[model samples]
Target: MTLFIGFLIGCAFGAILFLGGATSYRRILGTLLLKDLWIIKLMATAIGVGTIGIYALDFVGLANLSVKPVYIGGVALGGLIFGIGWAVSGYCPGTCVVGSAEGKTDAMATLAGGLVGALLFALAIPLLSGALIEPLSFGAVTMPDLLGISGIWLALPFGAALLMVAFVILRERAS
Candidate 1:
């Protein structure tokens, strides 16, 4: 049941991404160039909504929030790699999947590359664990935990701020 629900939600999210032009190289490039803010806005909105929903579910005892460990070096390295890949391919992982579904050859290549990258990362994890995962890891701590507050309390304001960023702050450049 949970898997089915997750699949349905994923389908809805993919459809939203498709409708929002996330599958288009031109649109992605425009975003990278700061000439378009559509994808940014879409992502901000999605994150805001999801954050609030997840926290609310957890608060109501309907969800279990699993926080991942935070390691500064790992996060920085992962982010750098992700950004470079997105800039080079004009497709992030989610968009690549959607674009491949739409029969785009470039997207297919990007997806393949991403899969290969993930496999390589998995294989390297054991070797990298000491250097990347252990010394710097802050075990499963969230902002709310650090601040000694309820997640829902922080989530409400943070989510609202992101929603404002999406709907009110970010604007498309005149092009």
Candidate 2:
């Protein structure tokens, strides 16, 4: 049941991405170049809604929020790699999948490359555990923890701020 629900949600999300033009290489490049705000607005809305929904579920005892451990080196390296890949390929993992679904060859290649990268990272995890994961590790914590406030309290304002950015601050440029 959970798997089925997840599949349905994934389908809905993919449809949304498609409708929002996130599947387009041009759109991705425009975003990277700061000429298009559509994808940024879409992501902002998603994160805003997700933040509110996840915290609401947790508050009501319907979900358990499991925070991942933070490793500075691992995060910095991963972000650098992710940004470079996005800039070079114009397709992040999610968008690549959606583009592949649309039968885009470039997206297919990007997806293949991403899979290879993931495999390499998995294989290198053992070696990275010492240098990147342990020494810099900060046990599972969240912004609320750092600020000494309940997640719901921070989530409300943060989510609202993102929502405002998506709906009010950002405007789609004429193509």
Candidate 3:
């Protein structure tokens, strides 16, 4: 049942990505160039919805909160690599999957590269953990905890902010 539910969710997400034009390399390029705001809007909406849904689930005791250690150096390095990949290949990881499904060779390359990178990271983590992962670790902290606010309180405001961003992007796109 859990597997079936996950499969259904994955299908729905892929359908949304395809229908939203996130799978199109041209559309992704347009987003990178700031010529299109559709992807940004879509992502913002997803984040907003996800934030609210997650917090609601947690509030209702349907979900357990597990926070990962914040490794700022790792995030910065990952973001740099991600930005370069997105700019050069015009496919972020999720879009790469959708693009690959649609027979795009570049997407296939991007997916292959990503898998390779993941494998390499997995292989290297233990070797590099002391220098890379532990240096700047803030252990299991969340924004609400840091700010001394309730999770739900933080989530509502964060969701609202994301919704606002989405609204602005869509409004500008419409105009």
Candidate 4:
């Protein structure tokens, strides 16, 4: 049953990516050039919505969830690395995987880069654990939890923000 559900979700995502033209390196690179960010916006919205929904469900007692609090040093380091890599490669890891599905050879290179990045991280973790690795938390930790607000309450703003971003991205493409 779990396998079937996973397959269905994967298929749904595949169809979405196929229809959205997200599997193209041109579209992914467009974000850097400020040409077209439609695909990037769509993916970001999907992630934001999914995250909000999961948190909402957890608040309602319909789902289980857990999130470790943000580690500033790790977040900063990772963001710097990711930003540099994306700017240099013009394709982030997520976009690269989708592009590979649509036959982008550059996407294949990006995937290789991702693997290399992961390997390097693994290798460095042991040496950096003293300052970088934080202890894991066992239960849900979100904006609402951190701010002492309701999860569903936070969801509204998150969803709205995603919609606004999508609108802006789409509007730019339309113009």
Estimated TM-score per prediction?
Answer: 0.93, 0.93, 0.91, 0.76
- For the record, the alpha-carbon RMSD of candidate 4 to the native fold, in angstroms, is 3.5
| Ten contiguous residues minimizing lDDT sum, candidate 1 | 166-175
Worst 10 residues of 3 by lDDT: 166-175
State the TM-score for model 4: 0.76
lDDT of 3 by residue, 7-95 (tens): 89888888899999998766776877788888888888888988998898898898888888888878888899999988888888988
Per-residue lDDT tens digits of candidate 4, residues 65-167? 6556566677788899889888777677666776777777877888888899899999998888667756532234466667987777877777878777777
Residue 102 of model 1: what lDDT? 97
Local accuracy by lDDT, each model: 0.90, 0.89, 0.86, 0.73
The local distance difference test score of model 3 is 0.86
lDDT of 2: 0.89
Off by over 4 Å in 2: 171-175
The candidate that achieves the highest lDDT relative to the unseen native structure: 1
TM-score, prediction 1: 0.93
Give candidate 1's root-mean-square deviation (CA, Å). 1.6
* TM-score of model 3 vs. true structure: 0.91
Instruction: Please list the residue runs of candidate 4 whose C-alpha ends up more than 4 Å from where it truly belongs after superposition.
Output: 134-141, 167-169, 172-175
Q: What is the lDDT of residue 150 in candidate 3?
A: 63
